[model samples]
Target: MPSIWSPESDTHITAQYSQKTLDQKVRNKSALQKECGWPVEAKRAMVCLPLGMTEALGGQVFRSMLPGLFTQSMELLILGKGSKEYGTLFTELQKEHGHRIAILPASEASVHKILAASDIALFLANVESSPEVRACLSYGVIPVAPECDTLENYDPVQERGTGFLYAPAKNPEQTAWSAFAALARALETFKFPFDWKTIQRQCMESTK
Candidate 1:
């Protein structure tokens, strides 16, 4: 089963976080390095997103804005879970882009590890019910959610300024880029990850 981030369990986590507070998370600067093997001061603009959302988010205005926002070195990790059935479009995305694209088959444990190491989570599926977003928040990770219908009802932040929501959800690529940029900004802004105490509080509040 997909990981469920119900407020029922222990609420210190969700599925995504904002990368705006990168500079402030000095203590965690070590954790990301230690846990996911990312270099300290690793400021590459990257995003880990599900593939279906990418295709769904494909619109003109958003795609045009991405190149300017992300560095050529910045990477985008596309997680399909091998079930997204978005191969044709994704192939084009990689073909059009260069080394900036890294596609992976989704495995819960491995994805969790990647999220632990990643700076931002770009969720396009309108499915942010996973508690891992909260899990990411505890680690100072942030998510950029497309303002799609499914996500409209859920609070990506679960109440604490952990993640961000990109409105209109039109341009998948540009929204992803904007999310990547937002993550960088968020990391620099909220450096401190929420602890279990806070997570539990989130869980309690969200469940209600």
Candidate 2:
């Protein structure tokens, strides 16, 4: 059985969340760190993602991002119970990057906390933006995602510095490569001349 039930292929279950609710739920940064067991002030960038088998968000594309993630020393906080296939991959990743990878099941408090503590939140598939995007913006976490035609409302990476965007391609390999490149670029933003705080403020502005 899937973690979430969906009647339609593109259904966004629990994707509706008010900014006020997000703010209230994730108000205390210290509490968020405690709940998620992530260092609120870690030097390494923390990336949180909510993905599932139903979304076709796991497999090769996901595996491709691992190398880049490990190279950057980015701590990944994954939300969603893994399907059997992803579970095996997660086990392999954990063996190599035990200190950097955390696989977490979906829980309201933990989800909000993880997003609040993350420096970036990721969405790989072309489906509608997850509600976590808004939650991440509310907490000033930049979103790293692929640009898809089906996306409605605002684009987080509309400009150069607001957030990171990768060109979505027809070929899965190309798409994965693009996403990996974007992930690398996102990690680079934390280094040198770039004003991370200003970029984060811009991410919040894009959400409006």
Candidate 3:
């Protein structure tokens, strides 16, 4: 498992996995946008879906939410392959959204870069005890995940919690709504850089 390390901290660990300082994270985000051919000046939130794009993994729910989720200030980068139907769906969405949406095959080569650049890791399905979620936290990527025992819900009053969580619902529509609401809160917080950084720091620290 990947671990988060801060330069300011005296504690040390084995250097088995990659380590990043907050400054490197900022640079990586800009470099990733450039590598993807996205205009850096646009200043949009980079929302990443790194898991496989299958209905079993919330592909259908995400499809239903895409229209409302892809606001003018947000960009979607999907980094995995799955069903042909979803491949077609995302391809069509890319056509409609142009540079705002991108799909790339998930691989070891690209996973870390995507995590480093993304403002949020979006999970539409339950991800309790998921290594990917932990990896995202290690990279200081905020997660929008289902409410589960492994994660903590962000509290605005205390300015605490590592990421955002939404209540899971039996109904697909209700689940989608809950996910959307959680993401909306994240997007709103993104507007305030200081607060967002505080959350990012908390996310990185959680893995320690």
The best candidate by TM-score is 3
Worst lDDT window (10 residues) for model 1? 6-15
Q: Can you give the TM-score per candidate against the true fold?
A: 0.49, 0.70, 0.87
Report the lDDT tens digits of candidate 3 across residue range 127-151. Answer: 9888888878877789999988877
Number of the top-ranking candidate, with lDDT as the measure: 3
lDDT of 1 at 87: 58
lDDT of each: 0.45, 0.59, 0.75
- Can you tell me which runs of candidate 2 are displaced by over 4 Å? 1-41, 52-55, 127-129, 148-161, 192-194
* Candidate 2 lDDT score relative to the true structure: 0.59
- Order the candidates by lDDT, highest first — what do you get? 3, 2, 1
| TM-score of candidate 3 to 2 decimals | 0.87
Q: Which candidate model has the greater TM-score, 1 or 3?
A: 3
